[model samples]
Target: MPTATRVVCEQLAPTIADLAGNQRLVLETIARDVADGADIVVLPELATSGYVFESAEEARSVALRRDDPFFARVAELLTGTDAVAIFGFCEQSDGDELYNSAAVVTATGVVEVYRKVHLWDRETLVFTPGSAAPPVVDTAHGRVGVMVCYDLEFPEMPRSVALAGADLIAVPTNWPFTDVPAGERAPEVIHAQSSARANGVFIACCDRAGIERGQHWTEGTVIVDQFGWPIDRASGVARATADVFLHLARDKSISPHNDLLADRRPDVYPKGAAR
Candidate 1:
C-alpha cells in the first residue's frame, strides 16, 4: 500500500506592507501546521511581503534574499521532521531587480526558489518577470513543483512542470475577488481542476483571505486530486488539507490506450505564431 502524503494549504490573510507582522503570521502558521502532522504546508502568495504594493520601493522594502536568516528559522521548525513548506515572498536579487517568487523550504534549508514567470495586472510595473523555468524539487513527501499566483493561469506553465515529473504542484495565489455566476465555482478553482486532470497530477493552490487595500479576495484555497476533483477547500483564514498517494500521479493513463504525457504530439504543435 502506498503511503499518503498530508498536504495542507493555509488560507492566511496577510496585511499589506506589514513585513514584520506577516513574517510572524507565516512562522506561527507553519509551526501550528507542522504540529498538526502536515507533510507539506502551503501558504498564499506574497505571504511575507503581502500583495497590493503601492510602489516598487514598497515591495523592495520587504524583499528577502534566498540566504536570508528567515528561511533558516523556517527550516528550524522542521528540524526533526520530513515536512516541507512552500510559500511566496518578494525576492531581492543581487542587482536592482525584485521578483515575485516562491520558496521551497525544508528541514535542511531553502531548497529552491521559483520566480513568478507570468506577472499579473499591476505586478509587471513593480517586479521584473522571471526568465527561468519553474522548478520541480524532490522533497521527502514527494516531487513538488513550485509556482506563484499568475503563473498558474497559463496552461504551458503547469504543463512544463508536469512534464518534469512533478507529483504535486503548489501554487500560492492572492486572487482578487471576481464576480461569478450563482452556483458557479471560481475560475481559479476551475483552472486548478483542469490542470490537475489534464496533467494527471495533484494540485494544491493556497489563496489568501481578507481584504487588502480595499481589494477583496476570492479566498479560493483548494486541493485537487490526480483525477481533477477537489478533495478539500479552505474558507476565510482556515486551511484545506487532504491525504493523497503522491505516487499515483506517476501514472498518466486516462484510458487503456491514452497516456497523458506520452500522447503529446510536440512535433505537430506550432512553436510560434506565423507572421
Candidate 2:
C-alpha cells in the first residue's frame, strides 16, 4: 500500500500576554484533529506567545526553556493518541538566549525542534538566529521536517531537507500581507507550491491571522500535496480545515523516465551562486 498520512493545519488568532488562552486553543485544536484521525497537526508560528514585541524584555517574559512545564502539558495533550503536534514558540535557552522556534511533540515524548534560521525585521533584536539548517525526522507518518515563516522564503531551506528525504514539510508561519499580482494567491502560498513542486514533497502550512500589536496577518493556511496542488476535501472543495487526509507517497515521479529527486544537476551549479 502507498503510505498515507493525515495532516491538519490550524489558523488561530493569538492574543499577546494571554498564554492561558493560547494554550487552551492549541490543546482543543489538537484534540479535535486527533479525534478526526489526523496523524500530524501543525499550528502557526509563535502559537504559544503572540508575535510583535515592543522590546526584548517583553519577548523574554514569554520565552520558555525546553524543560519548562509548558511542553509537558503540550505533550500530555497527545497522550493515548498516535498524533503528533508541531507548533512554534518563543524559546529561552539555559544560556539566557532567546530563539524563534518550533517543536514536535507526540503522546509519548517530545521529538525534535527547529529554530527559525531566517529572522525577519525586529526579530533580530529579540530572538537569536538559529545557526543550523532544518532537520528531517523519522516518524510513523513519514519523514517530516519543520520550518517557520520567513525561512520558507529561501529555496535552499526546503530543498536541503527534501534532499534529506522529507516526505512532508510542516511550516508554522505568521504571514503578513504583501503585494501580489492581481488574481494571484498570496506570494507565500505560491512559494509553498513552488517549494513542493521543486522537491516533490508535500507541504502543510499553518498561518495565523488577526492584528496583534498593530501588525496584521494574512490567513493563508494550506495543505499542498506531493504534486504541489492544494489538497481537496471529499466535498470537492479545498481542504481548508483541521481534518484533511493526505497521501504523501503518491506521484513523486515526474515522468516515465524522470524522478524529481533522482534527476539533479548540481555539477554545473556554483556553490555560492546568488539565489
Candidate 3:
C-alpha cells in the first residue's frame, strides 16, 4: 500500500519586528499550505520576530505567551484543519526567563513548545537554554518532532528524536552566512540533508531570508527525503511536497548507509563518546 502523503510549505521571508504583521504572515501561509494539500506546514525560525534584534529588550517586547491573542488567532484559523504547523517565536514562560521557542500547533491548541537547547553566539546572553528536549508528539499526521536552528546541526539532537520514533522532524532556522564546505550543496542546505539522512527521518527545514540588520541569511529552504537527497530544488523559496513511506522505511530498515540510529552499536559505545 502507498504511504500517507505530507506537504510542507517552506516560507522563506524576513519577518520585520511587527507582531501583527508577523502573525498575519504566519496565518496566511498556513492557510495557503493547508489549501494546497499540506499535511504539515513549517515556517521559518523567528517567524514571529525578527532574528537580528538590537537588544534583548527589543526581543522581549515582541515576546508573547503561547495563549496570547496572536496565537489564539492562529488557533482559530487552524480550527478543523488536519494539518499541523511549527513556527518560532520568543516565548514568555513563567518567571522572568524568556526562551527562544518553537510551537507545534494542531487543530486543538499548541501541542508542544520546543525551546532551543543549543544557543548560537549572542543567543546565550538573551534566551536561556531549554532544560528538556522536546518530546516527539504523536499526531494524526505522524510522529512529529520540532527543533530550532542550531539544534539541527548537532546529530545528537535529531538522533534523540528519531530514537523516540519521530517519523518527521520539523526544523525552523535563521541561518546566516557561513564558510563551511557545502560541496554541491550550500552549507546550510547540506546540514539539513545530513541531519535528515542521519536520523533516517524526513526533514522539513524552513529558513528566514533577506538581509536582516547586516547579517546575510542563506535562504536555502529545502525538504529532504530518507536518503539525504533533495526531492526538490535546493535554493527555491516555494512550497514543495514529497511522498514518503515512513512506516516502510522504518519497519523495513531502509535507511541509506545505516549511519545514525540504524547502525549504532550502543552495547560497546561508551557514554559521551562518539559511536
Off by over 4 Å in 3: 1-3, 179-183, 233-237, 252-262
Q: Indicate whether candidate 2 or candidate 3 has the larger lDDT.
A: 2
Q: lDDT by residue for model 2 over 92-137, one digit each (tens)?
A: 8888789999999987667888889999998999999998889888
Candidate with maximal lDDT: 1
Model 1 per-residue lDDT tens digits across residues 164-193: 999999999999999999999999999999
After TM-score superposition, the amount by which residue 261's alpha carbon in candidate 3 deviates from its true location, in angstroms, is 3.5
Clashes of each: 0, 0, 0
Which scores higher on lDDT, 1 or 2? 1
Clashing pairs in 3: none
Regions more than 4 Å wrong, model 2: 232-251
Each model's lDDT comes to 0.94, 0.80, 0.77
How do the residues 1-275 of candidate 3 rate in per-residue lDDT, one tens digit apiece? 65576757465564567877887788888887777777788888888887887778888888888778776666677788877888999888787887889998887888888899988988887788998886697877678888888898887888888889888888888888666555555676787787777777888778776777788876667778877888754353565566666564365255365445657788877877633
Looking at model 1, report the run of 10 residues with the lowest lDDT sum.
266-275
Angstrom error at residue 157, model 1: 0.9
